[model samples]
Target: MRTSPFGRTALSFGFFLLPLFCRGSHSARNQTANVTLDASFVVVEEYAFGIQGVWVQHREPTNCTQSPEKPRTRDITPAQCNRTCFPGSFQPPRLSDCNKIIESLLNNNTGSLQANPHTWVYVYYESCVAVFENPDEDSPTLQYNWAVLGANVKSLVNSCLSTPDQNSIGGACVFDEYDGKQLSNVEVAVQRFTDFDDDHDDDE
Candidate 1:
């Protein structure tokens, strides 16, 4: 699940480009390291969903001993982590579009979640990408995209649509709740699968 250099470069470029329209402040530029970008999967004319994020890996110390000479404590950081989602493998569902949808709704003064209770949101992988979708029947569509450095097309169906096993990459699902703190026991099964740029205003 190594991230391709092309993907990394595209993501890095996307990071710097996002700040211009996002916050339009000096802080936004410096905050790229922690920034999360929203994107969608495009599936013909029916559905397009994706996640809004950057796959970030934070290092933690290990508990394994480096050598017998020192007899010191070491830590084995699991290569797999919940915070990090890699391409080509369905890591556990680490990203969600619930907040993004909520934010979009609020920005347009779309009232509250209670007003529109029939909601479904999720994050899935397609053609190596981790996509999240929340379609709006009431409004015109908007386009937001991000490049996933290590996306792959393996098990795109099982991970997203079929009943996944212990090793499957099926996405995480959330419902009407804006915070999405309470997760549904049943993950949303998608029947189909398919599917950014930035300018620093005056700068590149």
Candidate 2:
């Protein structure tokens, strides 16, 4: 049986995290009293049946013996985890609407939205609709060439916030992020919830 790209990525990630997990376990064992570790956040890429989507996992803190061997993770709902969770204040784009857009793109049924034959699109939580040029035939591998589509982000958020009916939002929008550069891999683009500071001046 062939391993899917998603499986391969997960296996690799697991291997990369083995040492960290070991260290965490060791530390837990040595603690005199039960110690609670900080919660971890990750953006997971899920691909199955040739369809890809992203979701956020908020791993709750673990207290050595009180918690199970594996830390518990809570899958954050799109509504709860959005731009509002970040430092900068902005109305977050509705993830349900973004899901519709991704579905349309995957089914090749985008009505007004035109994506290049060589481009692939997916949503990065409530942040933005990420677009990337399909890797060349020579590469044939899906590279992490994704970049945020500013125009699409604006349109989607505006539509979701202003329009009462979400059913009409997906097909009516246009997607154009061809010139976008400074791409990053979807896997490494994980958002850290613990890194935000109340006094920080930077805005998203």
Candidate 3:
């Protein structure tokens, strides 16, 4: 299936992250506003999604006595592993409002907010990365095809996070280092999570 520019598989995920493009900050826009953000007081722990959106490093189970260099792959029936989990399938942290998150960031003027672009990109991508669990939606192939998913995520990041020109909403957003083969290593790593046997035949 052709995915959305935001890599959300044409699902609700696109809608969920929609506010990213709206405006910088209402406080920043309104000159008379009395609000001021204190980045120093902002606790990293308060950002539940940011802290939890981590990928668990894969390890061979102790039950497996064999060489981990040649790990086993699942031949799960369609009924068992019926669906692939899109990034949207996994529950986002207790974050009920993206606006609140934005407002909080806007208010912060201390050390925490110093790395704006890097911070923005980091949390944004990690929120999506949190959905990399095994798929719950049915797929003809295994859900962990790193090439496919990584490519899709990259597309989504570019589509959703990039800033657009104010006068031309449809015009291209500014390009960055995220383009091209940047996801190659990610794809290679994700291949380990799937049952993709290139030589296996239908008869096998």
Candidate 4:
């Protein structure tokens, strides 16, 4: 599948993620708005169906993890297995939204996100659109070029509680010189939660 440039723009900042529709998912555009957005954000609306006024293959949502296909090839970090649970990549976390994926499919309101585990998908909701009114609310942060994402997942996600310090868990993404300073910064954030456990807090 050709990844959208709009998607590139949205995630380039490590924020503002959007989703793209696949090619087989397009048919004809129904009704849409003409909202000029940055090239990066535009990919958020790019779909097989084309942009607004273009065709959109209609179907309900599908389970992103329903398939057994070995999930998208992912690069794991050395620190990956160090902790019992790593924070999930996506935010506003909702497994039920995947259920909504099924609902949208059944209603034929929009095309489903065909994916297996490890592949993160997102779509804008009607309510969200009512606010921004932009068609690119559905963000597929996982669809980002594997190379960039792989790198971020490895280093960017390295926030862990520090050793020796009872309060800090934020650590450098890897075993690098930078880890010490970031660990120091966390000493400040820990002030908020006196009992906060950066990695795994054991106590009162």
Which candidate tops lDDT? Answer: 2
**Tens-place lDDT digits, model 2, residues 1-204:** 211111223323321121011112222221221222223312112222113334212121121122224332211111111221111123333455354434434443212222221123233333323332221112122322112233333444454433544322121122122233221221111212111222333243
Quote the positional error of residue 188 for candidate 3 in Å.
17
Writing each residue's lDDT as its tens digit, candidate 4 over 99-155 gives: 222233234422223322222222222111100011221321111222222232223
The whole-model lDDT of each prediction reads 0.23, 0.26, 0.22, 0.22
Task: Give lDDT tens digits, candidate 3, residues 35-131.
Answer: 2222221211112222222222111111223232533232211111112223333232222122223333333323121111101111221122212
lDDT of 2 at 39: 31
Model 2 residue 2 CA deviation in Å:
21
The global Cα lDDT (0 to 1) of model 2 is 0.26
Q: Summarize candidate 1's per-residue lDDT along 20-117 as a digit string, tens digits.
A: 11111122121333332323111111122223442211111121112224222111111111221122232222223223322232243311111111
Where is the poorest 10-residue window by lDDT in model 1?
A: 16-25
Candidate 2: give the clashing pairs: none
C-alpha positional error of residue 76 in candidate 3 after TM-score superposition, expressed in Å: 13
- Pairs of residues clashing in candidate 3: 6-156, 37-107, 82-138, 83-136, 83-137, 83-138, 84-137, 85-135, 85-136
Q: What C-alpha RMSD separates each model from the true structure?
A: 21.5, 18.1, 20.4, 17.4
